[model samples]
Target: MRHTDLFYLLALQKVEGVGEINAKKLLSHFGTAEAIFAEKSHKLKKIDRIGSLTVERLKDKSVFEKAEAELRFIEKAHIRAIAFTDKDYPEKLRHCPDSPIVLFSNGNIDLTNRRIISIVGTREITAYGRDFCKDLIATLAPLDPVIVSGFAYGVDITAHLAAIENNLQTVAILAHGLNQIYPKMHKKYMSQVMENGGFMTEFWSSSNPIREQFLQRNRIVAGISEATIVIESAEKGGSLVTASMANDYNRDVFAVPGRISDKYSQGCNNLIKTQKANMLTSAADLVYMLNWDLQQPIKPVQKQLFITLEPDEQKVYDFLNSHGKELLDIIALECSVPVFRLSGILLNMELKGVIRPLPGKLFEVI
Candidate 1:
């Protein structure tokens, strides 16, 4: 965006009582941020939702000073400001009614024709969640989806690392400004993340990573992706908030189930039980649900006429054969195999061409 245009947009944001929705409305009527400022007070008041008080606030000239300072910071820091009208702005997020008018981004970030998904969960990630997240990203590597998450500890950082390891573009939505990194400990990963994908935020340089900022940042994380997956969370956490937001935006939501006794699993289990999210056990579930086609055509697997199956693989195959199509959890339960172990057994069966993986983590006999 042009520097002068960005300057006006920033000033528009500083207008008290003017938010994303109202700002967008004014912009629509006037066609540009400059025009909105140039319009007469009576003309602005004629628009719906633009009350007299808001018109008065729009006359505040101090906002221009703040916008100019922010513009200088953006220029010095080499940050790219993505306006709502920019083709480079995230398409999914752009469609959101409450999306920020401008997004500040840095690094080699690219979202062109990319499949984006957000993975969020508890900060106190457990071994099970970590392994699941790693394996999930690894499996999805073939599809090459862009991973989005908060640049925080635990699940968010784990997801980002997994994406980096797989050579996938990973974007970290910051709760604060680009001028500083939060947690301080994550400063080491910043370089690598910037090289691989980059950092994005709607906050200005003056903003800090406070509690409310994180909550507000969650909307971008949820809205920017086609789907949001909860790896693990307690009965209450920020991941659930993202899931709720994704659902509200009419995007698909998935949750990894865990043992009932595990505190971190309670939230995911509740989401599934309450029909708020689909049960996610494998990358196949997400790919299928999102209707994401593989970039390269998958080679057809030919079944060996007399392939041998190990005892565990035979059990899984037999269960799938009888059930027609069964979820991973159900096959594990009926066949008495641990989920983690069953994953390997199922993969082997799939390689043998005796069973085929279906959407939503279901498997069927070939």
Candidate 2:
């Protein structure tokens, strides 16, 4: 975006009662912020929902001074001001009605034709959650999906590290400005994160990581990705908020199921039970749900040749092997197993690579 246009856009944000929705409305009607300011008061007031009070605020010349200062700061800091109309702006987020008018980003961030997924969870991550996160990332590494997170502790940091370790681009959506890192301790990982992906935020350079800012940041985390995964959360937490936002955005959401009594698992279990999220047990679940195709050839599963299978798994495998290719129901009936139980058996067999699951629950021996 041109500096002069950005200056006016920044000034538009300073106007009281002008938020993302209203700002967008004003921009859409007037074409540019400059035009909005240049228009007569009566014409401006003619816009739907643009009250006389807001028009009066728009006439406040002090906003230009603040916009100039912010522009100078952005130039000095070398931040990229991604306008909502920019071609480089995240496509998924651009469709959101409440997306920020401008996003401040830094480092080697790229979203061109990338598969993006957000991982969010409780700050107090448990051992199970950590292992699941790492294993999930490692498994998904083959498909090379971009990971998005809040860059906070526990599940957020864990997801970032896993993505970094797998050489996947990981974007950290900040609650504060690019001028500072929150929690202070995460400063150590800044270099690695920037090298792999980068940081992004809608806040200005002067904003701080306050409570409301973090809550506001959740929307970006949810909207930026095609899907959001809740690794673990309490019955109530920010991760749940992100999950809810993802659902509201009409994006797919997946939750890792944990023991019913486990504290962190309560949120995920509730999401699944309430049909707010799908039960996510492995990377294959995400891959299948998102319909992501592997770019590289899948390495032949040699382990299946020597791998052992339990009785139920062996029974299902044998039935599928004899039947050549069969639907899940047929395999279940032939094996004398219920459909619910057979689903788990087939999933295990698929993971073991002894059997391959086809579309419509059809399975055949590999």
Where in model 2 is the C-alpha error above 4 Å? 294-355, 358-363
Q: What lDDT, from 0 to 1, does candidate 2 have?
A: 0.89
- Model 2 per-residue lDDT tens digits across residues 1-366: 998889999999888898999999989998999998888999998888999999999999999998998899999999999899999999999999999999999989999788899999999999999988988887777667899999999999999999999999999999999999987999999999999999999998889999999999999999999999999999999999999999999999999999999999999999999999998866656766776633324445566448789998888777777779997668878899875456556656666768776765577998
Q: Which stretches of candidate 1 lie over 4 Å from their true place?
A: 294-338, 341-355, 359-366
TM-score of candidate 1 on Cα atoms, chains taken together? 0.88
Model 2 Cα shift for residue 323 (angstroms): 9.2
> What C-alpha lDDT, on a 0 to 100 scale, does residue 146 get in candidate 2?
92
The per-model lDDT (C-alpha) reads 0.90, 0.89
lDDT of 2 at 158: 99
lDDT of 1 at 6: 99
For each candidate, how many residue pairs have backbone atoms clashing (under 3 Å)? 0, 0
Worst 10-residue lDDT window, candidate 1: 292-301
